[model samples]
Target: MNAISDTGAAGFLARFAAMQGRLPGDSTLRLAAANAFRSLGLPGATRGRRVEAWKYTSLQALGGMSFRAGAATAPAAKGIVFVDGRFQSGTEKNFARFADRADFGELSWPDRDPMAALNTMLAEDGAIFQIPAGIDAGLVHLTHIGTDGASAHPRQTIRLGAGARMTLIETMSGSGCYLHNPVTEAHVADGALLTHIRIQADAPAAFHLATLYVAVAAGGTYDGFTLNTGARLTRTEIHASLNGPGAVAHLNGAQLLSGSQHADFTSVARHAAPKGTSRQTVKNVLAGQSRGVFQGRIEVARGAQGTDGYQMNRALLLSPDAEIDTKPELEIFADDVKCSHGATIGELDAEQIFYLRSRGIPDSEARAMLVRAFLAEALDPVTNDTARELLEDAVARWWEGQAA
Candidate 1:
């Protein structure tokens, strides 16, 4: 805890003070988070010091903008929806509003992460879903809609009983110049399986900052994927902990950035027990003056022998001005663990484009086809049909905008 910026911290704390009475959950926890937020402030926004976690991204602009808690309206949909973090539509058997039951869960560390602290301090509403033992929840749709000039902090919680299975699809889409900060905590019990797919397509001028924490027990599997192609500045951070033997985790994602957009995907996978396995594969495609970032780390505990972990980051620069940053780290205390990490950064192959062009295809179409081929291999891991179609449509729209 060090000195932080008054301009950013003061305004944020002030908002909390005004709404302290109306907010739910235990007041003691929220107050503690508020104290931490005041101490940490916005990373790189203050002039005093900087932290390594936020080395590639800055919250200076977000700290300066004063967003409102204005009302929002979302288009009618068949799935559950939240407008500015408040419940709006749809229903499920085991679903409830965060505003109704605001338990912050036991996984997050607001005292260490400033963004998590902010969300803990001021989160108003979110989705809370649960699954019974041995039951299979086929598919769950959760969507968030934002409005202009407003800010929303939503806290989501999902828990699965032993032998249960679930597939969750989440989307964030809106039209605004607002800010959306959400924190999610997921619990996977022994012999359970959870697949989480996220698509973030916020308004062009909006800002998005999200954090997710997951815990997997013995014989459990946590499969996660994210597609980001919207917002002016976005950062999605994930932390996964394997707490029992034979637990598995798969963290895979793709980022398509264009114009002056900036997106960062940071993740940490920790194996605390023996025979745990984790794998991560990330792909980035950038055009114009866009910038993309990927930072991933794998940690194996002292007794966590026989751990198998591997991660790879690859980026394709579509324009000379496009930029990408990659950082991969592996920390192991056990001698029998097998872990490896690597990164590749390059532009598209001109020969491939020319080969297709010589076959009488237009230059733009040929280039698009090659790019699709590049993304095809990465999207293979996603087995859900609806999720696959959603990713394809999002990629197509992004490419169309870039070509225009």
Candidate 2:
């Protein structure tokens, strides 16, 4: 690595190590992760867009910040609560219900990525949601907040037993110049189902990086949806492994950005067993000088025959200066597998806009409607009524703010 990248890495490690005593979880693992990060260094910048994975998005915002550890507050299970890394009184019952479970961190998943390792070393506290067998876990709504100069790593884990079902809605928002790194691990057992909806609308001065790891067993299903309309620099990465036959993974997300904002969505779906299915559809609407990125990869193992995988990324550039970069990949070793991936970048339909304007609809409203309709492909998969409504409202707010 060069001197700039080295300085950033060294500073990050030194700060994290100094705060090791204050971070949550076992010290042994934390130290190990920190040590690993020291050797990996930071993911550097793109040399003339040579790095395909990070060609459109820049890490300068995250690298320039001087991050300090923040407290991981407990969450209260109310109708809807916005949390900013603080768990106080009046949330005891909800906190205990989530944290006191016996299988808090039982599942074994290796953290090989440098970003994951950094999260492990700096994570202060996290939320845990475990659903028992044959039961339906109700809605969980939370808003994670961040403050200036405070770097918070909030870890969350959701585990479902056989025949279990649940829905989670988490919104990330905050003010000031902070870096929020959130790590989530979800395990779905045989015949179980889980729906995860995440909304990111943070302060434009903030930096957000989140990584999610999901494992699905036989007859299991995992559906994840993300709506990104915030942060100066944001990256949402998800990795799903279909570990057993008949497992299905569907990942969908939309990124609506304006001004100088940057958002990246990267996902990898692995089929480790036969008869597994994975689907991904992501949409990006960019305006002003914003930039959006999507990197999706699907992998089919040697013996994982009868696998079905599909991926599509579509971006609408609302401004001349706006940009979008999409890289869709497929690595199939199975002979009997079917997989396809593609991306399209275009502008708003001039004819449609003209027709809508001639019909007495304002241009702004017409464009917003078109954007919403375009994004519905990714959002419509969210079956939970409340979560869908909330996401729609968030998208509306973002449009209203960015409307021309």
Candidate 3:
């Protein structure tokens, strides 16, 4: 390592030193990432420096603990499966392993992000997806499972050629206490389309930190949605760049949190070219002592004339102890852009519940109905029947827990 590290970071660096030779990538890149991690350390780990990007959340629980690799198991899945952090099995074509191929991709900035640097130094395996031009891959599934006490880092790449179309359904779930850190990069060529739906259902005692970077070219689209309902601590960060004229990007999601759970959804959308559009809407339902955070930022470059961007974040609190924090920002250098952002935080309307009760509905059922109605708008873009069903089922289970 190039510099001193904190205790928690020292533990990870020690593991990297013990296992660097075994990691299946170019040693130089991994070493550089290690040095980066050594210098950056974990956010809020020691309070030496503050990272505004991580102002609303902390990795205290993950940094102080030690985790081992999880056992891999073979489960029947249509597309691909990752056990722990390795590519255990897959039934899909046009795919490869990151460990076997060593494809780090071009979109991520490990030097700038601590978690990305950590993943870069320790990732053992991942998946590579490629869709050929003019081909329509209707649907595919990606699953991640981490058994007890595991620390897994998986790095993946996704590419869609011109005029290609694909829908990706991602499911993340595990058992016991573990940490799942995955970084993904996606490139959409001209006229390509990619639809992504992520369902994160980790164990209640687990930690999940995920980051995604996407670049969309002219006439291309990247439509994505996330549903987060599990984990003791979770943060999902996304960066989407509209690099060419007429490009479109949508980052939408919802968080259903209860108990002492903490979840953060942060996103940045940049319009780098003229005539680009970006949209985001995130909803949160908090119960018990849960806490939810949303941070959304939009940037319009000086040359990005005719840019259109909009974002809205809303939160519903079921109990007095529940809390929500929201920050919506727009940084535009273009005069010809139409950009706007807003946030709303409140509890369920008592009059609305009363109206529903007058129609012969129970109070719990009435509140549930209103919550579902609020989430329906955020889920409207998920048109795939299978993906929507998965999200619906997860939401239902979370609701059941709150009711109980």
| TM-score between model 3 and native | 0.96
Pairs clashing in candidate 3?
A: none
lDDT tens digits, residue span 1-404, model 2: 11122235566777775666765557788788777766654555312223345556567545555655554343454443424444333341133222233222533232456567777776655676668888787677666777676676666778889989888788888778877777888999999999889999888898888888999999999989999999988999898999999999999999999999889999999999999999898999999999999999999999999999999999999999999988999999999998999999999999999999999999988988788788776687788899989888998898778753
**Residue lDDT tens for model 3, 196-215:** 89999999999899999999
List the RMSD of every prediction in angstroms.
3.1, 4.2, 2.5
Per-structure clash totals for the candidates: 0, 3, 0
For model 2, the local distance difference test gives 0.78
What lDDT tens digits, residue by residue, belong to model 1 across residues 1-404?
22223346576788788788889998999999999998888887756568788899988887676666646777876589999878899999888889999879999999988889999998999999889989898899999888997778999999999989988999888886878899999999999999999999899899889999999999999999988989999999999999989999988999999899999999999999999999899999998899999999999999999999999999999999999999999988999999999999988788988899999999988988888887887788899898888888888887787877
TM-score of each: 0.96, 0.89, 0.96
Full-model lDDT for every candidate? 0.89, 0.78, 0.89
What are the runs in model 3 whose C-alpha is more than 4 Å off? 1-7
Tell me which of candidates 1 and 2 scores higher on TM-score.
Answer: 1
